[model samples]
Target: WARHGIMTTNLAEAYNAILRKLRPLPLTAIVEGIMYRTTMWMRTRRAVTLQQMSNAQTPFCKKMAEYLQEKANKARFHTVITIGNIRQRWEVTCRTKGGFGSSTGVITHEVTLGHESDNTCSCSCNKPKLLHKPCSHVLAACAKIKLDSTSYVSTFYLKDRVLNV
Candidate 1:
């Protein structure tokens, strides 16, 4: 924002100064440091509230919101489900969206199912694209069918790994 001239040098300097005090710390320390800074800064506002934070209507705030939304949009999912009898089969699902105009925009999904006898999931997402946990969609589907979703989740994978990767 400073480079784009959207913010003044003085404002950038203040942010940098606070960051300097935070940069040398470990991840947890840096998070706590920033949390303290945020508390102090909000205290100066006199009327800060959850509504105010949620209502960040400035252009910069909107851009930040869009960026975070993009990050969340890139998550992947994997899981096992009871398809026949008491037998379990693995499934993988991926989601992606692209395009400009509403008419041209499209949301794409690729889902794969695994065979128990072969110990393989048929979805492309199940290959080198391994996810750390079952997606909520799979969990929801299981719940809708009165099945235990937890039994399908592998303890080794987390949403963050599936999302970040």
Candidate 2:
């Protein structure tokens, strides 16, 4: 997936998997079947999104929200040290994880506030630079500094953007 920091040719593979059941059907029948399935999926997803909005729970479209939450959970095990520099730098140490294995048994990353007015933080892990999503280190730094971690998230992951699409 895009959030995992790399995109590959799996899209065509996924489409091929979707086309498996339609193989025996005529061309028109296959096209109609795909359309019907796509329509149903869209309707169901839209309904779910509407329900989420009604309940005041849709922070982001479900998948991105879950991904962010998983990173937030990891933030709890982080030790964020403010570096107090011009760039508002921070050192985030992973106490319970080995994102990059270290001989000392703790992984650390340097995080800095982005140049933009919006608080788009970046990490030494390079995930934010690559995937357009804040890595756990950035999230941890934001948490320590009382910044809203969500502000660092890419607009591509925003719920409103997804809904409009």
Candidate 3:
């Protein structure tokens, strides 16, 4: 299954609280303070990411790498089977997992690979196209064919792109 990141209004509420504290200040001073704070945040992020990149082997940023690894770990719980007449098309079925947070039952997805050497992957979940990252289904299908799933991942989450910020 694909993981969906939920972003709520808590961030805007926090920002509003900060702005309320600055409401009595002059508009020019408030704007300058916000700009300076944002600049410092970027600087701090860049420095920390630079250190993380130094020890990393993959091109993906640290978070992205961990996310992909989690997907791969989930992929191991899936059983992929070659379906239809095409070898590139596979059926990825989730194994029965019993736990407090597990799904109701086994679920299956259709994954079609347009090419073996390219990143053209279409899943029933449509996560790769929607999120620009390989979902567990894609990873399972790729593993069945001994293909690398990283090619299907977007470069936007790469270390180089994050470092450029």
Candidate 1 residue 109 Cα shift, in angstroms, is 4.3
Model 1 stretches with alpha carbons more than 4 Å out: 1-129, 157-165
C-alpha-based local distance difference test score of model 2: 0.78
RMSD of each: 14.6, 3.7, 5.1
Best by lDDT: 3
lDDT, ranked from best to worst: 3, 2, 1
TM-score of model 2 (CA atoms)? 0.72
Ranking by TM-score: 2, 3, 1
What TM-score would you give candidate 1 relative to the actual structure? 0.25
lDDT of 2 at 136: 83
Q: Give the TM-score of candidate 3.
A: 0.71
Candidate 2 structure quality by residue, lDDT tens digits, 21-106: 99789999999999999989878877766656654464677877888889889888899898867778998888645534667788
Q: By the lDDT metric, which is better: model 2 or model 3?
A: 3
TM-score of each: 0.25, 0.72, 0.71
Task: Indicate whether candidate 1 or candidate 3 has the larger TM-score.
Answer: 3
Pairs clashing within candidate 3: none
The true-versus-predicted C-alpha distance at residue 82 of model 3, in Å, is 1.5
lDDT of 1 by residue, 79-162 (tens): 334444444442323333454434545332233323323322233333212442334444433433565433333432222222
